[model samples]
Target: PNDALYFGFGKPPILVPKSNAIKRSYSLTWPEEVVGALVFLGSLLAVRGVYALVPFLMALGCAAVTTFLTLKMWRLIRARELSFYRFNLKSAGKLRKAGWAFAIFACCWIGLNAHSGWIRYHEVLGNFAFQKIQVPDELALAQVNPARWLNSTQRENILEGKKHYDAASRVALFVNSEALPKLAWFEYLLGNAEQSIQLLGQAASYQKDESKALSLYYRGAILNRLGRHEEARSSLDQALAERDDLILARQEKGESLWQLGRRDEAVAVWTDAVRRNARLALVNNELAGAARSLGKLEEASAHEKQADQFTPNDPFYQWMLGRRLQALGMSELAEKHLRQAEQLGAGDGMPNER
Candidate 1:
């Protein structure tokens, strides 16, 4: 029930328009906050799948909003130095004050976005949002940074107290199942796809209370990654039978279908995921990917533009925006997004494209 209402990706960011532009009745775009909400929804169309995908859209959203407002404030401050534009340090320093606002905004915004990733076991899905949901105090645990795996003593403390809890009856016994895949994914980043597949296999065995649908869904994902399309499709179809909302399973199935040269079928699979998770921009991105593959550049651009409405400032957002423009044959605008994306940090938390 909790998962049903708050089921979108983490909350989309909040955008407060800087007062410098308009104090009156004229409006061009939606208010920044409204746009942020939509962007968040668009990014989360994959819904829970975002968790498995290395926190991409949320990070992208953060980058976009930060870059745009930061630049806007920067310009506002400099506006004073110009003669007619005028530098009267008498300025309330609201422009400079924006730094404080953004600082708080970024922290709160990113914290909410990153909280699930950082503390998946801590709060049960909407435990933070809806007050009525009761979460056990024990559930407030944080993640162990794999880079700094717990020392034996710390690990002993956690396992000693929590080890005996009744996970056998848990709906999410497969929850920790994510840990090994994440480890393997990092290894995959370092060029070990085979080893990553092996790790995911191992993780699959630990799942205790998994539904057949979920089991097949995860297995399908692994098989697809391993290039075993026929098997992946079988598993995906089974998962879909149980829960039509399994976006990742459907996504993997589509990938497998595409690899099998069933282009139309692949598109159909993705289109369903997009419709189910309308908030996830990545689904739309996947749509764009399919369009590009079909040589429908204009169509790809349209979908990508919708993605841009969410994250307008980040360099990567700019880069993606530029790519969409290029698809539409707009060389200059495309170049701008490309250049900005290059300037921002693309490598941060990003998996190797290979």
Candidate 2:
């Protein structure tokens, strides 16, 4: 698990100007200076525009370039190469002070970008841990302790029950341009449904295609939680219209339909999703309840078996299943999952538990 290679690739190598090179005074022409200024400003703007997509790498590059440029600028100042139109002790003193100020600003800029990149690296790691559940321990236990993977410098959660996602969300706000959708999800995880909705709204202008569909789906799920079934259904419909393969969107749409008194349509949607992905344990659980309500005892038993087979030992997953089942009026099954969630430390404020 040597991460030296990761650091090597993640950060740009430092460049040191050869000290043995002949010192030559290079006078800056007015036109050249103006062009250089334009190029630097343009680079900054370009980096800003694309940083959200490739945050950590862009940040590290900026840090490295800033450091290199500052060193070059300092060397020029020392060599008196930038004194093309300056004279007198007063002007010289002012120039030296300005150089010091610029140097300090560059140092701060480099440090901030490096720090942002480092934090973003942790966010990526946390995501990998959560999304890639192929680890033997996770597979065997059907659970993942995200905090054990993250071990982030910003360890304090904004909320007690929420896990390591808060750190990722916080860092994204600084270095990610396309952070709104992700922030929405994190806020939702932290139980801030209204805040999540607001972020999704803001994300609308920045997202395209699948990202837009994702935001719409998040909005739908949040609306469902807030008991706004009509709005939830509308959002979910839009999401599915854009990307029909979004299984979670289909699942939430089913929730909205069920809440709006369209039980058959909800059942149909759940059935379709289950057909597409049989491993969706929560959907199976939902279908199990729906079948039981319709007096289809054998079908209900089959769906229950599927749920039991696919459901993970993940505390958050169990907690979510419990909440969704409770909403479906499956009190017995809901309480069972909720109790299991509690035993697995879902709301006990111990996110590191296996």
Best model per lDDT: 2
Worst 10 residues of 1 by lDDT: 136-145
> On a 0 to 100 scale, what is the lDDT of residue 265 in model 2?
99
Positional deviation of residue 267's Cα in model 1 after best superposition, in angstroms: 0.9
The residue-by-residue lDDT of candidate 1 on 232-262, one tens digit each, is 7886887787777778778767767777888
RMSD of 1: 28.0
lDDT of 2 by residue, 273-320 (tens): 999999999899999989988889899999999998998887767866
Superposition error at 87 for model 2 (Å): 24
TM-score of each: 0.37, 0.56
